[model samples]
Target: MRNLEIRQFPCLSDNYGFLVHDSESGETAAIDTPDADAYLKAASEAGWTITQIWNTHHHFDHAGGNAALKAATGATVYAPIYDRHRITDVDHWVADGDRVTLGVHVANVIHTPGHTLGHVVYHFAADRVAFVGDTLFALGCGRLFEGSPGDMWQSLSRLRAWPDDTVIYCAHEYTQANAAFARSVDPDNPALADYAREVGEKRAIGLPTVPTSIGKEKAANPFLRPDDPTLAQSIGLEGSGPVDVFAEVRARKDRF
Candidate 1:
């Protein structure tokens, strides 16, 4: 099987849009439609037709462009089953373990209800790539908008099971700020420090720090390490359960 081609571009103020293409089938999918014009332009420039739209959640920024994009390209929109009521123009509803395909490339849907109650991520296991939406980020994770800290923690724990080399594509450009917050909590982590510096260098030159890997996030993101004694200690929650530790960390980040 051939590897799918991906295009990443900035949308709105901080959101990132993705286009995944399978050359063999001449099929292309818009990962999420933060902005219709942006995805349209990007697809036009790539000379690929938008054949499918995969939505990760019901958030406006994530699904707002669906109607417009679908109208323009006549593409089918696949959204999470739980949030189908919130998203318009959905042609299919997918739940955890459901598979979506772009030509020969298939992605498994993982229900990750943290940032929103019905949030999901698309994992293309064969390609070792995941479009994580807002559930996970570089050195950070999404806020508990509709779900509790425990809910978000459990959701993130699902992502932790992916292969370490899986490349994660989160939806926003919040790495620089997230790095600063990460350092404040996990101050002595060598991995976090290294990651922070690299993020700084990249942002200094206007480069994106996204497309982070499961390995890098596992090593550096405190949000993903709530079970670690060191992380728990840093938050003054020694011996606390992972849920408590995660809740404390989320609270701190909320205030950060």
Candidate 2:
């Protein structure tokens, strides 16, 4: 089978739009519709037909362009079952463990409820690629908008179970700010220090720091290291449970 080709482009002010294409079947899936015009232009530039729209959540920037894109390309729209009522123009409502295909590439829909009550990430297991829409970021995690800290921790724990080699494509350009916050709570971590340096360099040149790997985030992301003693002590919660530690970290980030 041919490999899936992904196109990532900037949309809105900070959002990123993705197009996943499979050459063998000649099908393309738009990961989200942050901007229908942007998706259409990107698809045109790549010479790929938009056959499907896979929405991760019901946020305005995520699904706001659904109707326009569908009307333009007649593509099928797949959205999270939990967010069906929030998003419109959905052709299929997928749940956790459900599978969706584009040509021969099949992506597993995993419910990651933290950024939104029904946020779902698409993981292409064989491809070792995950499209995490706001659930997880380069050096941070999504804010506890709809779900509690406990709920978000559980969601992140599931993502941490993926193989270290998995490549993660998060939906925002928040790495610079996240790196700064990470240094505050995880200053002693050499890995985080190095990652922060790299982020600084990348941002200085107007480069995008997205598509970070699972190993990197697992090693340095403060949100994913609530159980680590160093991080707990940094926030004065040396012996607290992971959930409580996570809550403190999330609260600090909110105020950051």
Candidate 3:
């Protein structure tokens, strides 16, 4: 039996550090570490030794604590080779199609460059999990920092091809804000309204709005549903191609 546990460490307001653990083998890995102390504290509490660190991008908020955690736990750091120099102590530089093993489980690296030139998402097929750093989010995609809008659009499109049941572990807690934007784009979407209400209630009670399934995101996330006519019409680019619609929606959200 394969068991997956996702623990979110809230860092830098909305940034989240995700811990993935396989209880069967007592093996654990972390996706992006913004706060070393929080990661260590969580590991201690969970009684799982950190064995690996997967970096989706080289952004400071995502890879900031890599050096400290590596030194403390001696965990093998896996990162994309494009920005090897920027990330410290990358024991293994992975590319798209590369498969990494964690105990009996395996994660396939999908080089999704947009949020950064070398951003990568780790997909555990058996576990139906994907650790998508900044490239993709719960309800919104990352800002175009290192790549063009086209690059981000393509990256998100590839992610959308995954099984709808796949669970998305994004790098931030931006659901509430993103859902707000989604509601504005499609006010008639009861799905978005209901999701916003549920998220608001979760936040009100100090709960984490993460581990969202791809199906839910496709139905609720305006960024991922560019083909929807309501979103397309809202952006004044109705009947446009999917990519064009995505660009318009992204640009609008950038200002929103």
Candidate 4:
């Protein structure tokens, strides 16, 4: 069995640093770290050495702990080639369609630029896992900071093409609030209503609602399923394409 373990470290309030371990080879990787101490402690407890750091974007909050973690573990850092200067100390600069290996698992690097010009997502095909940072979230998406709505829309479209079973690991724990916004836009969606209740219960108990599957998000995440006529109509964007509908939903949520 391909052992894939995802440990969520709640750092800087709602931010989450993920530690992915492949037990078959005992190799571990971290995705968009915000706090080094939390990752270090988790690594120690799990008896796994962080062999690589995969960065999705160049945000300070996401890459803040990269240097420190590299110094502590001597792990190789991988990032997009477009923003090489911003990532600082990137050992391997990857681009679209590049493949990187960790132990027995191989991850395909997809150039998902939207949140940033060089943002990327790592897809571990064997494990059906994808680490999407800032581009696609549980219910909402990252604000369009460096790229246009079209750019983010295309990026999300690429992610949507992945197998529905692919487990999505986002970099932040924004499900509760995002779910609320999702309900507003898709108030009649049974899946959205159910998901909101589930997420609320999890947050109230201090549980992390992460590692959500692509299939689940497709059914309930308004940002991903903007093609739904009811959602588009509710936002006053009737017959809009996915990108336009996504922009409308994002704008409304930004104000919400």
The residue-by-residue lDDT of candidate 4 on 1-256, one tens digit each, is: 7668888778887888889898888889988778888899989988899999998889987888899999999999998887888888789999999998888788999998778889999999888999998888888789888888889888988888889999998988989989988988888999888888999999999898987988888889987888788888988888889889988888898899
Better model by lDDT: candidate 1 vs candidate 4: 1
For residues 85-177, what per-residue lDDT tens digits would candidate 2 score against the true structure?
A: 899999999999999999888899999988899999999999999999999999999988899998899999999999999999999999999
After superposing all C-alphas onto the true structure, candidate 3 shows an RMSD in angstroms of 1.4
Q: Rate the local accuracy (lDDT) of all candidates.
A: 0.95, 0.95, 0.86, 0.87
In the order shown, what is each candidate's alpha-carbon RMSD? Answer: 0.6, 0.6, 1.4, 1.2
Q: Kindly indicate the candidate among 3 and 4 with the higher TM-score.
A: 4
TM for every model, in the order presented, reads 0.99, 0.99, 0.95, 0.96
Over 4 Å off in model 4, which ranges? none
Which pairs clash in the backbone of model 1? Answer: none
Where's the lowest-lDDT run of ten residues in candidate 2?
Answer: 1-10
Clashing residue pairs in candidate 4 are: none
Candidate 1 lDDT tens digits, 147-169 = 99889999888889889999999
Against the true structure, candidate 4 reaches a TM-score of 0.96
